[model samples]
Target: MTDALLVLNAGSSSVKFALYEAAQPGEPPLLAGQIERIGDDPRLATGGTSEPFGQSTDGHAALIGGLLAAIGDLAPGDVRIVGAGHRVVHGGARFDAPVPIGDAVIAELEALTPLAPQHQPHNLAGIAAVAAAYPDIPQVAAFDTAFHRSQSEIAERYALPRGYAEQGMIAYGFHGLSYASIAPRLPALLGPEARRVVVAHLGHGCSMAALLDGRSVATTMGFTALEGLPMGTRSGSIDPGLVLHLLSERGMDVDAVHRLLYDESGLLGLSGISGDMRDLLASDAPEARFAVDYFVDRCARAVGSLAVSLGGLDALVFTGGIGENAGEIREAVGARHAWLAIPPPLAIATDEEGVIAEATARLV
Candidate 1:
């Protein structure tokens, strides 16, 4: 049997998976697909084939199990998954690079769920599911925050007391894997001018990172993924006083506030339609237009801030779903910062799964 590497990126309502030949480098996946709408009308698609997943259960375990089973039935008989890699959203201060996942590592990662409540649980769920499915296979975790470990003290710290920084309340940026994948490709695409780069990752969860010589100097996200640009459902950066008012004056509990900020806010709350940029772009509604406009405005503002963090801008890269495909949004953001005189923003398709697979391959 031929050895293969499996990479899983499990989200709140979906699980994306890819299988790559273990020895293959700089090649596309042998198979790739995703299981979407886990709790409601789950469906699986691979290689242009779509079908009902037929699983009664929901959540990470069920979705992952269904995906594995489907791959078993669909993949070539010679392809044997030898190892796995998982995209963990938060690594805190403990992990700076992809590490082999053991029981102790799992425990430490579980403790970090509070920092990335929306993503870390699902990420760990993927790791657990894969371990259960393939008992003997080695698994590695590639963190989304690992690449941002290069940020300077000032960039990582908040204005709060020094004690908070010691307690790990400092900024831990997300989308590091995406940024890492993009950073190396920048110089080849943009020449030496890629030295001072600002990469905007604008998908369901959006953030920007400033890279100096392919290393993170700063990022828009702070202690949590919610502390960045307005995302599909997240409220990005909000005022602490507003949260306090909700708790004291509006009778909102912690859970309610969390739900509002992480699930009901951002594009969804702004438009009162849908959080998807595709839907907003397709709609003629004025509210949808307003939400898109707001997102572009905020992204442009973030570019200006990141430019300052880098001292200047050489090239601005646009990745992720909205960044790569939403021409109007990129055009608007670019126009807003025409004074920067940076090269035209380059829209590069992010290869997060590929990055995860490569990280896992190194261990195997």
Candidate 2:
């Protein structure tokens, strides 16, 4: 069997997988599918075409089980899954680049749970299961932090106590992998201008980066993923005073605060309908439009802020769900910066599966 590389992005309700031929340069993804609603959907494939590879009561386990079975059936001869790549958010101060996965690494990742409670635990779960499922297949973690390691201390430091910064409580940007995938492509696609670029990664989890000379100089996210533009369900940036007020005056606890910031904010919080950009764009409701506008506004402002960091903007690249498919969002964001000598030319972010495939190939 030709060796194959599998890329997994496990989310709360779904497990999205992309199967790529382990080619030298990672050309294309051959197969891609997702299993959704673990216990509720009770089906293997999101569309219900396949049986549940492994039934599960928990969201994380459901992804692992479904992915295992899918790999078993893909009889891509000689093309067994020789390498697996996972997207892990918040590698903290430890890992600022993609690295091989192992027991010690998994434990370290587990230790950073408090850093990214919503994403880290589940990400580790996928990495661990893939290891157990195919002990021989090399598993690698392509961090969302790796790309942002070049950020200057001014861009990464939190205005908190010195000790907190020393204790790993400083800003370590997310969405580095997406930006990393787009940064190098700029030189080929945008010529010399790609040297100074601002690429917006907009999805359920959103962030933007200013890449000067192909290094992350500034980004939208801060000490935590919570400090960027409002995301699907996350409150991007909020005054710390409000959090303190909620705890002291309103008597809200940490979990309560987490619930509101992570689950009850952003598009869902503003629109009271859906967090999906497509859904909001399709709806005529004022609330929906407001949510859409807010998302675009924050993104536009972030572009301006990062542009200053680069001295100017040469081009703009959009990735992730909303950035790639939401043409209106692209047009709108580009228009905001039309005042610039050259408005950032927008393009579809390259294949993430291909990026991971290439990363794994180099290591394994």
Candidate 3:
């Protein structure tokens, strides 16, 4: 019998999970899978196991049920779920690293909803589902904003006043779990003092972080998730004045502005078709090319600025969906940073699921 550690990463429309044979810290997972479009007919895919689980419209609870059913199919007695880990997007300044979830922790996460309304609700939903599914198993919270919590106050703080800053209005760099997964490896990828590293995590969402000795010295995202690089449908780094103009001049309310920034911009807004990179790349529409070019240009600029922040760049690491799969985006970002001498740009497939399994195993 092997102890299995289950990990759930719930996004806006889907939930992904990995079931690994629980081992010591830093070990890899045994099997992994994900279910996209959970509420509607979900798309289920597995890593080690090849047979695809077909359409089911049971939502997150069904997804969990499907996973449990799948595990049962593979010698239920051998696969013991020791613990579960979840990826929560924003922790504000409350969590500096991964922590065990509790009633107080749930309260703390609930309080930060205003900081990450798009993700926090779904994150809590997945967490709540897990709590209900496996009430006895110990669950852990792995904050995407946690690793960057090591960033200096000056780096995280905005130029705004103190009251809002006290109310958690600051830059809490995201993709911390992904960043942390590749951090220690940077030294091996570069050198022991690999002091200056700029990592761009481009996926459904995107952000750039300037790391000095594995700790976040600066990052592109600020105060909210919408402040960084343009993503699948997110409008990044828009002027604050535009927000006011939208509210006052364009008859847009707070919720309307939020949707525009969080759901209707980026590639979808530019291409006027799809938010997915693959779809845009495959399309013949001029808007598709325009959207792709715009994404690359902005990301290149962010890397240059982040590289400047680190004095110079030692290594440029790419992770996440776009970074790992889209060779074109990486090449574009790489071409921009070619001035850096020796050790050509490196792109590593980030293992957030693996990282979660490892972290959860240690605490369990």
Candidate 4:
């Protein structure tokens, strides 16, 4: 039996997992797959094929069982999973690095749920499911906010009162895992000139980070993931006063405002067509074109802003779904930044699971 490390990134509707040989740290996963559309119509997407997955009464628990069964079928004999690593979003100020999973650590992460409502619960659920499945296996929680802890105090702070800043209201950036995966590869890709870089992780949930000498100096995302570039469904970085106005004059409750911003906005709200960038790019509708333009505009503006933070831009790196796949978006954003006179933007595929596997290996 081969010893392996299991890495899991659980979202609201899916659990993305990969298994890597613990002994081989930076290698590709032995098996990688996602259990997507969990509640409504669950399916296992692996090896470029989608197959129906039977639902069970226990939610993530049952889903995890099916995942283990699939993993069993892939190898010759029993593949022993030595360790598990989870992508826990919003580590807050408490955790600046990956920590071994324990009851106390889970409780601390649970308290951070309010900061990342859309992600935290599902992340915790995945951990719980894994714990139940492999109770004896050592597990580690690799946080998305951990890498951003290298950022300066001023860059992470809000304009709010000193008291609020002291009480953990600082800008804890997300997408650190993706950025971490990209950082080490920059030296090989850009050589000595890889000092200052801007990485735009444009996906369903989008954000950008300004890296100075491969460490986060500033980022577009703030206290919440919603404070950055307009995403697939999120209304990133809206005026705070507008939220208050909705609560007072627009006859909208807190939950209503939350739903509108988190679920009904972004490309879908702008185009009135679809949230997926591929859908918008393909459509002939004026609204779709406008949405695409708006996204590009914001991305360009973010690059300029992050470039200022990095003193100047050396290179701009793109990762995540839209970044790696959507060439049109990249061309448009790069066109807007022509005056910067930097090297051509590079599209790099992020290895978040690989980063998790390595972290878990070091910890265990």
Better of 3 and 4 by TM-score: 4
Compared with the true structure, all predictions reach lDDT values of: 0.89, 0.79, 0.81, 0.89
- Candidate 4 lDDT over 302-342, as tens digits, reads 99999999899999999988999999999999999889998
Give residue 188's error in model 2 in angstroms: 1.9
Model 4 CA deviation exceeding 4 Å by range: 12-14, 37-42, 54-65, 75-77
Q: How does model 1 score by TM-score?
A: 0.96
Residue 55 lDDT in model 2? 50
Clashes of 3: 0
After TM-score superposition, the amount by which residue 260's alpha carbon in candidate 4 deviates from its true location, in angstroms, is 1.0
Ranking of all predicted structures according to TM-score, beginning with the best and ending with the worst: 1, 4, 3, 2
Model 4 error, position 287 (Å)? 2.0
Off by over 4 Å in 2: 11-14, 23-25, 35-58, 74-78
TM-score per candidate: 0.96, 0.90, 0.92, 0.94
lDDT of 4 at 310: 89
Clashes of each: 0, 8, 0, 0
Candidate 1, 22-54: lDDT as tens digits: 998348988888886666568887888878885
Q: Worst lDDT window (10 residues) for model 1?
A: 54-63
